[model samples]
Every structure is written in C-alpha cells, then in structure tokens.
Target: MVREPSDRSSGPEEQEGVGEQDGFQRLWTPHRMAYIKGENKPSGPGRDDGCPFCEIPKGTDEDGLVIRRGTAVFAVLNLYPYNSGHLMVCPYRHVADYAELDDAEALELARFTQRALAALRKASGAHGFNVGMNLGTVAGAGIAAHLHQHVVPRWGGDTNFMPVIGRTKVLPQLLRDTRALLAESWPED
Candidate 1:
C-alpha cells in the first residue's frame, strides 16, 4: 500500500494518498511517544502523586539508574536524556523550589553535583556540560513537583543537523551501561 517517490514522475505536491512520499527517509523513534504522551509524569504537586524523583531512591540503584547516593541527595541518569550520560542531582526530600532546600540539603546537593561532573568526565570524556535547574513548570521543569539540577554532557560538534533540522537526538549508549560506568568513575569523598 506504500509507493516510493520514484514510482511517479510527478512531485510530492501532486500525490494524494495515506502514504505520501516526501522524499526523505524517516527515522522512526516510536519510543518517544511515551514522553510525548507524558507517561510517568506526575499528576499533582505532591510526593504521593507519583513523583519519580521521590520514588527513585526507594528502588535498587541499577533499577533506578542511580549513579551515586549522598546523605541528603543522589545522582541519577535522566530517563529521557538530552545527551549521553545526562544526569540530575536531586535532594532526597520532595521540594519544588530551590529556596526550600535547608543548609545540609543544599551542601550535599552541591557536593553531589560536583561529583556527577567528575564521574561524567572520567566515564565518557565529556568535552563540556550544561548544568542548571529549570526551577518550575514555567521555567521548563518536566517534573515541577521536585527540584533537580541537570548535568548534561556535551561534546564538540554534538549539535548537528539531526536535532536541529530533524528534531531528533542520537544517543550512543544505553542508560544502564552509562549508569554503571558513571558509578564506577565517581570520585571518593
């Protein structure tokens, strides 16, 4: 029921059917549909409302993709990463805003973030990093019920036509493998 563009001499503008050839091969990423449909996303602004950051620590490290755990905070790989080895440092307590962090939580969060960067560098040889928090829903926080700082690894020429023109990112490694590598590469206290 599908016809290639070469089947007809006419251009795409003249085609009329369900399978209209646009002259470009598609890179189907059906897995992205879960993210697009907001699966596993929290429904409310509470820990009891299925906050992933709150529940992640309860599971085993490998199951949760957690790289390192601190007294007040932990580092875990982002399920939908912007790049390979992209991880977030999150406080154990469920707090929506950065100002809500206490002295101990703040200190541990900072230390965990530093350790995340070091582990990423050692594990993947990341050239640079994009580190920051989205703050709130309006500020681009996917899970606005909990505060988390992202540490996205970047390399030279990492930004290419795939994400720019095609609106897709090509991650080379699996989340579990990346987590294990980062956990091993994490620095000592």
Candidate 2:
C-alpha cells in the first residue's frame, strides 16, 4: 500500500505544489517540470505518434533491450521506464484488446508473469514488484496494442524529496545490467 507522507499537512493550500523545497532551485530540473506537467496533463507514452512499444522493433538491438522471448510472448525494457527494472511482456500477435488472449496463452502468460517477478527480485533483490496492465488507451497504456504486462521493482524509500522536491531519482543500477541479471536468472520453461 502507498503510505501517505506522514508530516504533510492536510490542506489544499499546503499542497499547492507539494511541500516546502528548501532550495527552490531544485525544481528547475527538466525532469521535475515534465513530471509536474504530466501530473497536470495526465498523459503517458500512447500520446506519442511514433509509438515504439506498439510495434516490435524489427532491426533495433533486442539483446539487452529484449529481456526474454518465447514463442508467442516476449519481454522488453520499457523505453520510458518507471524504474530501472521496469519491463513489459508483450504478445507477438498485434492486438490492442486484452480479452483477445487465448486461454493457453493467457495461462502461460500468468506463469511467465510470475517468473518475471521472481527473476526481477532475484536479480535486483527488490523489496517487491508492481505488476499490472493498463487495459484501455485511456488507462495510461502506452502501446495500446499488443497486450503486455508491466513488472516494476519497488525498493523501500523509493519515493523521496528528489522527485517531489528535486525531481530526480537515484537509480542504484543500470538498465543494461538489470536486463542481464533478469535475463540470466529467469527460469527456462
């Protein structure tokens, strides 16, 4: 569960932009501005016309990018990732809707999805994972097509003033290394 910040005041004015940033200069970072704008806009990857996540990149490097690939399923790094270990397992057949998943494929996906969690945890020693799929385009889904699932690693105290105040995150690991760790540790089925 997302524990609300304890010291925060419970008043609209108090949260006009979110609590005191001792250094007003920290908010100048572009990432924070975009984050603030995103909060107001409430849009994500799907808004991009050249949606990379929708179509499987044919010639682009998938070795470090694509963490794993099965017959009908494949896992890739989320280009605009939530965290270092963020990944998405997508179906080969291009279909926007989630209800299109067949029983067998869906079942395998469930099993593999569990594997994704296990592998990420094994690789990163992540405290936990946030696994989910955004159903419709309106639901913050980036690709909208090719049903996929997200696996985001969560560590204690991932949230800090950096984002709220400084607009940054101190990611402890590189995405490439994370890919290698998860790919290597993932169980073969």
TM-score top scorer = 1
The TM-score of candidate 2 is: 0.69
Each candidate structure's count of clashing pairs: 0, 1
lDDT of each: 0.91, 0.68
- Residues 61-166, model 1: lDDT tens digits: 9999999999999999999999999999999999999999999999999998888889989998999999999988899999999999999999999999999999
Off by over 4 Å in 2: 1-64
Question: Superposing all C-alpha atoms, what RMSD in Å does each candidate have to the true structure?
Answer: 4.0, 9.1
Q: List the residue pairs that clash in candidate 2.
A: 162-167
